[model samples]
Target: MKFPAPLVRLWHRLGSPRWFFETTAPWLPWLLGLGVALLGAGAFWGLALAPADYLQGNSFRIIYVHVPSAILAQSCYMLMGSCGVVLLVWRMKLADMVLEAAAPIGASFTALALATGAVWGKPTWGTWWAWDARVTSMLILLFLYLGIMGLRQALQRPEAAGRACAILAIVGLVNIPIIKYSVDWWLTLHQPSTFKLTEKPAMPPSMWIPLLLSVLGFYALFIWSVLQSTRVVVLERERRTQWVQNFVAAEGSKA
Candidate 1:
């Protein structure tokens, strides 16, 4: 049997957690800096400087924060599931760290998404909560995150926990599309995306500039945070190893 070269290479790399850590750690600080700068700029420009919506007025500004967070929330889970699938198929330890690193961050994003959505809903829809398809689906997504985190912690064996979380993540992926297309698929109260902002963003540079930057900023932040947390997860999982102890001791001596 011939093994695909790329897949074989990926599987080999995935087998080593230390390699993944060393490869990704150097990028985290740079990504963090870029994320903060772009996100701050986008939030300020979109929320304060951009002209109010003609229909909804000033209240619509919340979308600048809400929409981005919500979008990231759904996308992050998909990324997690994709990582899980890769881990299970390739038998990669790094894949498990990726999943653990993402769980809390994804859950936090989901919470932020739901919170911001409710706040936006109150002003636009005249209600804070709704039984609408979109809202329900988002709520379910939040639970799915909680479940994955919970399942991971509940299991004793590292491999068993990782496998269980992977399965749960894959099964819960059914809700991603439901959240994405809820507005289109149902007669829900949630509004669809529009093409305008700031006296109607007349050009792509005007509107999409921030949109793209904000999305990238969010993704960068997600990756940076995941890398930082994955370091912790790796340390915890490998605490008995000599490397982690020596690394911690070296840091302490420096301090």
Candidate 2:
């Protein structure tokens, strides 16, 4: 079967590691700048400018951090799962690098979500931790991330490790929906999401706008971190190649 021209072009473009590196290199600075700017703006606006929650008061400021971290954690897992699929089906090396690069970032965000959730819980729930369905599921998600990272590290051959990690990542996708819907699916201390696509937001625009910005900023940060890490992976993986040798030599001469 013949694929469409555009689809074939896109497939080849994305599958090429050198092309991916060259194309993304120029955008990294811009991505970092945008991420930092939006995050700084959102932090100031949400933590100081936005009105306090009627009941939660200043403690509610934690949402700015907690919500974004949790959202990114889940989204990152989805990205990893998609990359795993591409690696397994298309045998794309770039997909493997992406999957590996995303693991630690996803894990970090998951850890942040748990930490901030615990901190937020202290004042709201009068406890540091609880086995609420959402919380427990999120913890499981973190473990899944760690498991993938461990699996990758354990294998000596790159191809074997990539395949193993890809399978693990694809399988772990089952937990994402559980984490997302756990609040609705079970009796839990965690409240429902503040932002919903189908209805008006739970909070006023003044509050939700900054939150929206925070989410965007966090997403940008995730992309930037992944790109930076992927570049390192590319360099290491391609170190024996002529292009990498020339690139290293150029950098050395500049230094």
Candidate 3:
């Protein structure tokens, strides 16, 4: 089937490693700067400026980090799954690179979410671990990420590795909804979200504002990390190409 003109153009543009690398290179520093600034500001405001919870007290501050990390972790998996679909259906090289680059980052964020959750739990729930629906699903998500990374490493051929990882990523998409609604669907120790798009947040503006900043900052950081890693992947994968060789030589000359 024929795609719309704009989508077709976008697909081709994204598939070209050289174009992607060059296009994103100039934006990297700006992206990093914005990410750092937002994150720093959010940290300060959330940890210091936002009033403590009447019930949870100072412990509520952990949400500034935990919520953002959890949100980003789920988003990263969705991103990888989307790339997996593109790689499988369209056989796009850039899609494969994106999927590969995203796995470890997703894993890191998932791990952070779990770690922070455990830390928060120690105070709130009086335990470090629980097999609650949300926590269990999130743990499964982390394992899925590790599985994809491991599958790619185990495969010898690039195409084989990409296909294997893509399949796993696609299958793992099921867990996203589970993670999101686990609290509603099952009796769990984890609390429901304080902020919802369709409704006013349970939190006051001062608290939710910093949480919003944290979310945006985490997303920016995720984008920056993915772009940086994708650039390196592109270079290594395309090292045999004349463009990459010339690019390397140009850099070497500068050094």
Candidate 4:
């Protein structure tokens, strides 16, 4: 199957470490600024302006943070899984760099989700922890992230470590669906998805609007974080190369 010329060019460029670094460098500050602005707006709106939930009251406002974190957690893993496939099949260096860069960020997001979920749960469920399917699966997701990082560091050879971590990432892709469907598949304290693309949101625009902003903000920040991390990995791995040496010299001169 033939892909479009533009898409093919994009795919190849994305695989190039030098191209990736140079292309993304100018966008980092913009992305960071936009993410911060949107997140701040959404947080203030949700915490102070949005109406309280009749049942959960002010506590439900935490969804602004919790939902975005959980969504990014899964989304980041999916990205790693895609990179894993690319690394295994095409042996793209950028993919390996991405795997190294994104694992810790993904894990941090997962931890934040779990922590916020616990805080939200205390008032709603009257417990800080539970063995509920969705919660348990999310915990497993965190471990999966940790396991991938550990495996990568454990191997003596960089090539072997990248291959092993890629395989593990591919294997762990199965858990994403389980996490998504757990609330529906079994009885759990967790509620069904609050927003759906096909269906209208159960909450009013005043409520969902801030959530939308927060989700977009989280995504922007996630991209910025991953790109920044990947750039560091690229520099570290390519330090001996002329391009990297020149790049470092240029940066040092600016400093």
Give the best candidate by lDDT.
4
Q: Over the stretch 1-255, how does candidate 3's per-residue lDDT look in tens digits?
A: 878999989778987999999999999998889999998999999999999987778988999999999889889999999999999999999999988898899999999999998998777666788665667778878888899999999999988899888888888896667655764476434444432212334899899999999889998999999999999999999999999999999999999
Clashing pairs in 2: none
Full-model lDDT for every candidate: 0.78, 0.87, 0.87, 0.88
RMSD to native for every prediction? 4.0, 3.6, 3.7, 3.8
The sequence of per-residue lDDT tens digits that candidate 4 reaches over residues 132-169 is 56576788899999999999889978788888999999
lDDT of 2: 0.87
- The number of clashing residue pairs in each candidate reads 0, 0, 0, 0
Relative to the true structure, candidate 2 reaches a TM of 0.91
List the lowest-lDDT window of 10 residues for candidate 1: 191-200
Candidate 1 per-residue lDDT, tens place, 67-171, comes to: 778888888898889878977887677778889889989899989989988887787777787655667677888988999999998998989999888888887
List the candidate 2 regions with Cα displacement exceeding 4 Å.
Answer: 1-4, 178-201
C-alpha lDDT of candidate 3 relative to the true structure: 0.87
How high is the lDDT of residue 220 in model 2? 92
- Across 1-255, the per-residue lDDT of candidate 2 in tens digits comes to 999999999899987778888889999999999999998899999999999987778998888889999999999999999999999999999999999899999999999999999988888777788766667778888999999999999998989999999999888886567555764466434554442212424899889899998999999999999999998898888899888899899999999
Which has the better TM-score: candidate 1, or candidate 2? 2
* Model 2 residue 234 lDDT score: 88
Candidate 3, residue 136: the lDDT equals 72
Error of 4 at 132 (Å): 2.2
